[model samples]
Target chain A: MKVRRSERLVDMTQYLLEHPHTLIPLPFFAKRYNSAKSSISEDLGIIKRTFSLRNRGILETIPGAAGGVRFIPEISETQARVIVNELCERLSEKNRLLPGGYVYLSDLLGEPELLRKVGQIIAAKYKDQKIDAVMTVATKGVPIAQAVSYQLNVPFVIVRRDSKITEGSTVSVNYVSGSSQRIEKMELSKRSLKKGSRVLVVDDFMKGGGTVNGMKGLIEEFEAELVGITVFAESNFSGCRVIDEYHSLLCVEEVDVQTKTISVIPGTYFNK
Target chain B: MKVRRSERLVDMTQYLLEHPHTLIPLPFFAKRYNSAKSSISEDLGIIKRTFSLRNRGILETIPGAAGGVRFIPEISETQARVIVNELCERLSEKNRLLPGGYVYLSDLLGEPELLRKVGQIIAAKYKDQKIDAVMTVATKGVPIAQAVSYQLNVPFVIVRRDSKITEGSTVSVNYVSGSSQRIEKMELSKRSLKKGSRVLVVDDFMKGGGTVNGMKGLIEEFEAELVGITVFAESNFSGCRVIDEYHSLLCVEEVDVQTKTISVIPGTYFNK
Candidate 1:
């Protein structure tokens, strides 16, 4: 059915937001709205300007035949800072400090709004890079990876602690567990990644970066290229990490369980 | 910042799509767009009409001092049928059959677009219900749960196969694994839910419905109410299932490993 300019603007914005980082030919929208290419172009212009003014994202237009508009989701540095600072505050809560020096993160990671914010910040860092997939270890990192995948319009694969029969063939890698300093095994399905794929690795927390190193190993095993590594938070308490370069949204400066006091600061991501 | 009506419609539509199931008072949009209440109302009317005409969702308006509008996402029956049919064809692939009568579903679940559609379908079913949270067992169910949670604009709590130290205190339940017929333990963080909270249980697959029942046990332990149960797929080869009432998008009738044949049909969700 044909739609007027107002209806087109509303529906077009909704569709673009849902499908970030993907190219949609103008004719596709033109046909769907039963409008001419010229009118569709005008509607996209409004959406693009509004998106930019609001810091919602970038609307990239490709010219000529087989070209269209793409929504590249982004977050302004100011908004990103606010979100990270708020997360630091939440992380510093005394009761969140659990035994074994690990703070409770289930609640924070479960919130869709928070996850999306964190995802936007982290995704913005690699928005310009060509990332074929988002990789994360199973359980906690699943939510974060899923959020980023949605923003990047990419599929995410989970690397599990233990292999499930349903995953078919698997690739296993062993690395020292940062906290325990003991060798641990992590596995990803052989079918999850194609060789030479560019992968971005993300996780909920980082200590000595052992888990990130472990995932790096799996990426190597699969013959895939590691585009980058980032974590939601990393502990500053660790003196040395296996992987030196990475991005973190929050840095845990201290977690004094005995004193029941925790300190968190914005991550090195800002410093970079 | 002040904006014109065209820009406001574009931005307003983006905001409403991002924050589904949340009530945003007219004054909020009015203030955000720096427009008069009357103008905002007119803009919302246009958005509401476009939303309905596109079958995108329902833009519900409430009139009162504390009233606002809520976006309840919806997927039309026609689109839902098309998506489910495509899923059936994909699941019936000969290579998808694995040993132990299991099918490889990780690839399908990892997809953001397909998962969003599935999420919309499941979320549409319970959009009107009072659901405090959506619950699923890790690790495959995480993506599906997150997608649905996005649609419903609610938090999702994951039930883990094994409790992690980071989860703090957890409540564990032992259920007989449908495929293995052995008792398996699943756990949920004690803080993930509040007592008497209304919960919806979702999973990626079901055979004898052991996992769903296990989640129900956790919900019972937490003193929460079970609003509903649903799955992405269910195997029907088994003559009996512990669960009789549930919704499934796809049903697997047979997975003949020897002959390398697989059969999938649309699930009971459509019939109901």
Candidate 2:
């Protein structure tokens, strides 16, 4: 396990990136790398400065017997805006407009790199808030929630439209479906979230915000507090939204089915 | 943003980590960091050495007009075994056993740190293959697939038990449920995957391997090739497996519902 300082720096950087928001005692790294405490501290200092200059994240160093270093993944507003604008351009493509005004977003969401950027942007927005877990509905929302949760370094809970035997006992709630305008039931395992936990809700796309609202109700049933709501894209043509407070990366103003035209703009993320 | 060599190294490391399996021309980094090509090359050398020593991944330097550096995320066999062993210990907890022999694994799969490790291990297994996308079932498998796809820098497609309007046209396939011994239908959006793709199938848990087989059939329907199959854990008690070729991180040897006991061991990953 003996390694040089240069090698140590590389390993430490990877380690810190993987364990964001978790405090790592200097002694642990020192022991792991078979290095002196002073050397470990120097390596961390280099990492912290690099992370800060690039706005990659914050590396806080604590000075105490029980203290260590922590990596907080964050994205600068300028960088986030640039990313959102690019996303807006991609989303405005006429081919994205599908039947019934639904947009073809699976391609964008499926790309890991895009998801990572989106996750970083959303996670940076809520970095200052205390979040216990991330919540999202099944299928489409899973990747979005997973990305945000990865950046926040918290467990994500998946709420499903149907109950599965493997989930054991689940708490189900009925809410009005946004597009369908029909009562729909969503369920979450009782063990997924603990009582009094603070949860952040994320999704791939939002139209009437009914699905997000349903997740909000599920949070209450779990006796948890909603920290915030974020979505990759929201549709302005949905008329009225059930929820008012939320953050979005892109906003779709119009989708003309006959003309095969679509208009997209940076979402609330830039407004702030 | 003019940065020092130390700062450049940190940023370069982060960039390479985020963009794995993709070549970045040295000039790009030189321009981005406002540094000379020679300086960037030296920085990449340091990163390459560090990554190799730590077995973090491969930092390949491709020489030519179009070549630069490519980061291939990898984990050594020794490291993979240790991680799988630790996972086996966690999976052996008696409390994880749920009703009808189901295991409560939502927590482990939800943790970003753990998922990153699992993803690295599984991705390392298929690093040499031509994998265009990672495929998985909806709900539990999304995170695992996302993690692996993140490492491979590829998109992931989810096969869902139920179809949503947002997914547009989908292709459906029927398979026998391993646990319930009942036939079930799974669907994937027709546009989610492209024909002639080499897809790596992944799942959170496998019992009879029915779902994985169904995914295999679905892959054939799309005219895509199956690179391999990997799962987080498989139950040893499952009488017979439908699929014989696969890799698993951990194996649940015994889950005594009456006695409230569970036994887990390292899976085929170590055997290979």
Candidate 3:
């Protein structure tokens, strides 16, 4: 359809935001908007500059016959720190402390805005990596994985604690639960991942790192590579983590059950 | 940040996209951009007109001392039909037919772009309603709920088939599994939702409507009102649906296991 330059700019901005990490040829926009290639190029130039100045994302322009523009969603370090600190403060509230020294994160994780910000922060860290898919355990981890996957523009695979008929054939792995130190099984659908795929593992909480390790084992069973591991929060109280080399947005320094208090700090992201 | 009008427009577009169905005062944008309220108003005018003309969403201008702009994400009927038609084509693939007459929808649901479209279509239907939260059964329905919640800018609660310690103090309810016709229990955390909320129930698939009905019951137990029910797809072959007054994007006309074929058509959305 025919469109004005101002309208084209707005449409292009929306289009780029929706299709992050995917290359869009200028001709595609030129044809869609019934505009000239030169005009579309100018529109993208404005979008690219605005995205960078606002720290919204990156718009990379390629110069070649087979080249196009790509949008890479990113969050600045200042913005990331602000978001994490706010979360830490919220988490430190006495009401967030649950039994067995657990901090209630369901309410925070349930919010789409918070999830999106968390996803952007996590995805920004791995933007340079070739992540084929995101992996996380079911229930609590689904939203985290979904958010990160959305930013990275990749599908997320969920590892379930129990087998379901709906999932068809699944590959199961056994590992010790981080907090309880009890043996647990995790399963993933056989068709969820292709062999030799690179996956980034994420979770809502990491205590002993046992669940993350279990997910690592599942990735191996699928013949996939574990690019990296990250979690929304890592407990300072858990004994001896089972895995190393990971990233976390927030660290639970203390959860005082008697006093009904919790202490949180910015995680490894800020330590760097 | 002392941004130019062009930069302000781009940043504003990105902000509106992220914070849909929410209001932002003019002074807030003016202060952020280091610009005058009049300039911010002009920028919003450009954005509002572009959004409506391109069918991106609705930019409502609330005027008064406490008034500002609210972005309500919307999908035009024509665009919604096109999106649903594309999904129908994808769902009709023979390979999607799984054991026991199930159509594999993980791939489609896993796609962020497709999920965004589906979410917009579903959210558009309930945009006028007082939806406090989006509710769905765990596992398959998480992504659908997440997408819809993203559009509505609200939190989503997941109902689990099996209990977990992570979700403390859950409210469990027994309902017959639609496909198996066997009694089963689903649980939702007591703290997941607030009482007297208006919830919109969503799922990836529906057959006999037993699961949706169960969720409706769960909503009542929480003292929340059921605003509406929506599914990605519903089975036409199911015997006697348990609930009425629901919306679906697609209908599964046939899932022939012996022939390994599946036929899908536009659902209630198109019927209207």
Specify the highest-DockQ model's number: 1
lDDT of 1 by residue, B1-272 (tens): 66899999998988888899999999999889788999999999999999998898999999999999999999899999999999999999988888887899999998989988999999999988999999999988888899999899899999998868899999999998766789999999999999999999999999888899999999999999999998999998455677878999999988888999889999988885
Q: Compared with the true structure, what per-residue lDDT tens digits does model 2 show for residues A67-179?
A: 99999999898898899889989998877777888898888878999999989999998888899999999888989999998999999989989888778789999999786
Cα shift from native, residue B115, model 1 (Å) = 1.0
Misplaced by over 4 Å in model 3 are none
User: What is the DockQ (computed on Cα atoms) for candidate 1?
Assistant: 0.90
DockQ of 2: 0.74
Q: How much is A167 displaced in model 3, in angstroms?
A: 1.3
Q: In candidate 3, which residue pairs get closer than 3 Å at backbone N, Cα or C atoms, i.e. clash?
A: none
Residue runs of model 1 more than 4 Å from their true location after superposition = none
Q: What overall lDDT goes with each candidate model? A: 0.91, 0.89, 0.89
Q: Is candidate 1 or candidate 3 better by lDDT?
A: 1
Best by lDDT: 1
Each candidate's interface RMSD (Å, one decimal) is 0.7, 1.3, 1.3
Every model's TM-score: 0.98, 0.95, 0.97
Q: Return the clash pairs for model 2, or none.
A: none
Q: Residue by residue across B1-272, what tens digits does model 3's lDDT show?
A: 57787777778888899999898998999899999999999989999999888788899999999999999999899999889989889999987777778788876777787888899999999888889999999888999999999999999999988887777788999998776799999999998889999999999989888899999989989999999999999989457778889999999998778888888999887565
Of 1 and 3, the candidate ahead on DockQ is 1
Restricting to chain A, the TM-score for each candidate equals 0.98, 0.97, 0.97
Q: A161-228, model 3: which lDDT tens digit per residue? A: 87877777888999998778899999988988999999999999999899999999888889899999
